[model samples]
Target: MKEFVWAVSIICILLVFGVVLLKYLSENKKYKNSSYGKQSQKSFWKIISNQGARGEYRTSQIIDKAPFKNKMLFNCYIPNRSGDKTEIDMIMLCQKGIYVIENKNYSGWIFGNEKSKNWCETLKGKKYFFYNPIKQNRTTV
Candidate 1:
């Protein structure tokens, strides 16, 4: 019984130490930066937030490669009467008219229609949902 108690106590102490060390490393960016922080180079949660920026960067590369006289405006922010801002990703001004483009950089199987209030994505045995990009872009027009 005493040996079992000692073993459990040791395990608890080790677990506490591990948690503290991890917290310290995460809080101190220098240690995380110096170490092989490849994951940290990516965004927090590796989810949909910064994924839009990444998708935009990739799309921008493709657009930049095209030879055209159209003007592409990126990240245009408009202020509302409430003093809040609405962000539009890419606006292409061509001979036709203004084309508003919104990108959703999501992985796995996406399940939703354009009219749906929210879009769902199934990734890694988990489900995630976000707003429909089409509806979100309509306000930019």
Candidate 2:
């Protein structure tokens, strides 16, 4: 019967969703238990799903392993000239001075000059344009 088929389909869909949710939760727990994850202070889903987050997390991991005593901050927001908040990916405080890091996680042939407002990335015969990191850092600092 049509009603019986519909009921079975719905049950199957729910079962699949439950399984996926369980798997995601399990993975997230494992990530949270790791040292990098703890330092990142981000959920597994967040780091894995967002490219920028993944870049920032990886940068944090590298900074943690460095042979120096430094304080690092992530996802910091500071007010700009326009009174709007600009998010800085990472910041490092050390004996040298304060360093602001703008991470760009792009996989391709990147082309841009420091003065350019935007940059280009060519991957798989496709081009992607993004704001220049140099100008972005200038604005943040």
Candidate 3:
């Protein structure tokens, strides 16, 4: 019984030391990498947000590349005077008319009809539901 207690105490002490060492190493690595990393490099969450913004910017660039002589504008997060104070993601002005674009940068198998109030996306086999962008845009208009 004395030997068993001694062995258990030693194992417990080793485990505690191992955990502390792992924590210290992890923090040290992060601190070292932070010094070398650039501030402009976006993190995981920032990349996700920027993906939609990038798409909107790309769409405007594509339109600019075309031979259309008319004026074009890309307005992001334009606020509405409605009670809800909704904001439009992007607004494009072309020869035809104004286009209200709502950018959704979601990675998944999206499923839904244009008439449906909500659409479903299966991201990594996990289901996610979001409101239709068309309706959201119409509400802003």
* lDDT measured at residue 61 in model 2 versus the true structure, 0 to 100: 68
Q: Give me the runs in candidate 3 sitting further than 4 Å from their true place.
A: 1-49, 75-81
Q: Cα RMSD to native, each candidate?
A: 9.8, 5.5, 11.2
Query: What global local distance difference test value does model 1 have?
Result: 0.69
lDDT of the candidates, in the order given: 0.69, 0.85, 0.63
| Candidate 2 residue-pair clash tally | 0
**lDDT of candidate 3 over 33-98, digit per residue (tens):** 431112224343343256765465445446556676544433434446565556665565667787
- The runs of at least 3 residues in candidate 2 whose Cα sits more than 4 Å from the true structure, single-residue gaps closed, are 1-36, 39-41
Pairing residues by index, what is the TM-score of model 2?
Answer: 0.72
Residue 133 shift from truth in candidate 3, angstroms: 0.6
lDDT of 2 by residue, 1-141 (tens): 999999999999999999999998987776676445766766688788999787777677688788988888777889998889999887899998999999998988999999999999999999999999999999875
Stretches off by above 4 angstroms in model 1 are: 1-50, 80-83
Most lDDT-accurate candidate: 2
Per-residue lDDT tens digits for candidate 1, residues 1-141, read 999999999999999999988876574453233211222344423322466765765565576556765667767788755678988777778777888888777899998888999989999999999998888886555
Task: List TM-scores for all candidates, in order.
Answer: 0.59, 0.72, 0.54
What residue pairs are clashing in model 2?
Answer: none
RMSD of 3: 11.2
Candidate 1 collision pairs? none
| Clash count, one per candidate | 0, 0, 0
